[model samples]
Target: MFTWNFQYISKARLSSTLKQLNLSAEQGDILIRIHTAIHLADEAVDLARFVKELVPKAVIFGTSCMAVINKGNYALNRCIISVSTFSEATVCSEVIPIMDEYTGTVLPVDMLCGQIKKEFVRDNTKLILTFFSGQYKDAGHFVDRCNDFFPSVPMTGGIASCAQNNQDDFSDDGFVFNEKGWSDRAILVAALSGDKLENLSSFATGARVIGDESEITDTFRNCILSINGKNAS
Candidate 1:
């Protein structure tokens, strides 16, 4: 069985925030969800620095958000960190980008499923948690690919946002290996299967979908030119 806990930190005391967590690397896995107004590079650097000093051994994974999830409320300019430890189940995780050398001009959606199929070819993958750059190309394509490949692998996580401008935000999430020293903004997949893991639980919430569902009428590359036969923007 696994137990989960959640916490959050703002940009004001990122360093102090990490210290306050009092995480131990020797302990079980810890996932960190960060919300920042800083640039992508800065956010990554701050995260890397904290992860190195605190809980160095835990498997830390999470995405940046405009509004983070903590105690059940959405807040801004803050970072939310969720930690989970496994006592009975063994978890295997992998991260991959939406585009790669082997994919070769394939639709972004197809690329996602292909990566999953390749990495978890043997493990009984149960869930995929991902954070995407709001400006990413082929966002819909990637979602479609996820549905096609592992229809059963429920996906969660938020699209990175730029709070100041309310424009496209770039966010990165990843699965880390303390021993291996690896990290990225790629899709993170977690495969859990062991005699001890008797039950698996997941949660997801998103923006409201108003009015009748409309069809995407026209699109070019990553932008939606039209929806429901009307111009999107």
Candidate 2:
């Protein structure tokens, strides 16, 4: 197995970063890490469009960050990307629709397990990575639901970061869509194994506080009316 890595450190206007990266898209696969330093949707769209234009054949997976870190420590208002080629790993990942009826329940678990079996075309999975949006969903609950389905598989990944109407550290909850037309609010699930994957690993970090810390005494479909025995509004 050969370990080849590519790092793109070029300076260009955010509007032209895509063009610059396209200049470097010469081989294998590309892993993208983007920081909008503003809105998650806006910055994500820029990178997604660039990926489609430059590395159309590469499998892209990444999250927006309040602080993006690479070989160094952490950074802000910067887009850091690391490209590596894996000749021995079989990587197949997908995003599923956000189920409205499967919150803090067992139904999502059952559905995910069945889907994984069908998607990867195998029931023997070793590692699974999942992420959910903090805006309209519960990340912890989703993780629990997934565990219920694949109790034996090693799973990791956390909720995506969210700032104000505009925050520098941000990433889309799921796959980038504005450019490639991905589901807007959905959960991303990836299953990898030594046989299918020559190698597999992942990590993430965030500083933006997502959602409210107050308790939800009562609510309905993205609207909460009360908290801690009192009216919220």
Candidate 3:
């Protein structure tokens, strides 16, 4: 088992980095997680293709990040690539499209949870990594619903984010991609299972609640309609 992290440079640099790892694409399977900044979004597809050529059997999964995080350092306009090669671990992933054109809404939380449970629940499964569109309005509710389905299994990941030059207008250009392709309105659930593989997750938030406590009185889909008996701003 081996894992390596790299900041995006160029295709040549990527080749050199992989060569330095001394990994055998022919002998062991590889899983790649790419977190890239919004400015580098256009290059992501090419990068995925390059990695595929380097390792024909590799399974690549990634999403755009508002800022790339690596080794305790945060960077914007950069990319972070994490590759894991394993000979004993079992990995599987499923992608579910979340768009609903009729209602102009994304998938409902209950339905999303049902699909994930149906596809990923297994006795040997150790952990699940989820990558969903950042444009999803109800990310918090989606996570809560996922927890309800697999309370015992650990889950971790982030929502895809894109760069927004205008603070008033948030862009919905973030995307998540895998071996199959990329999508802006989809959720990818990956499961890792095996006795040899151990999964660990940790999270940190920089925000603190300073205002008085308030209760959510009503909600419409992903929107907060009322708080403390008054209309939410």
For this target, which candidate reaches the highest lDDT against the unseen true structure?
3
How far out, in Å, is residue 161 in model 2? 1.1
Report the candidate with higher lDDT, 1 versus 2.
Answer: 1
Ranking by lDDT: 3, 1, 2
User: Which structure among the candidates has the greatest TM-score?
Assistant: 3
TM-score of each: 0.60, 0.58, 0.78
| lDDT on C-alpha atoms for all candidate structures | 0.53, 0.52, 0.77
**lDDT digits (tens) for residues 1-233 of candidate 3:** 77888887888999888778777756566788888774344466677878878877777878876787678887776788998987877677766788886886777889988888888877777789888886777778888887788887888887887754422232365888765667778887888877767778887799889899989999976689999999998
TM-score of predicted model 2?
Answer: 0.58
lDDT of 1 at 219: 94
Candidate order, TM-score descending = 3, 1, 2
Say which prediction, candidate 2 or candidate 3, comes out ahead on lDDT: 3
Quote the lDDT for 209 in model 1: 81
lDDT of 2 at 39: 36
* Candidate 2, position 115, lDDT: 77
Q: Give the alpha carbon lDDT tens digit for every residue of 1-233 in model 1.
A: 33444454444465565566666534444544344443353555556556656656555544444555557776655555555555544455554554455654433566667776676633445455566654456656777776777776666555555554432444333222222333333454555544434445566579688999889989975689999899898
Regarding TM-score, does 1 or 2 come out ahead?
1
Per-residue lDDT for 49 in model 3? 76
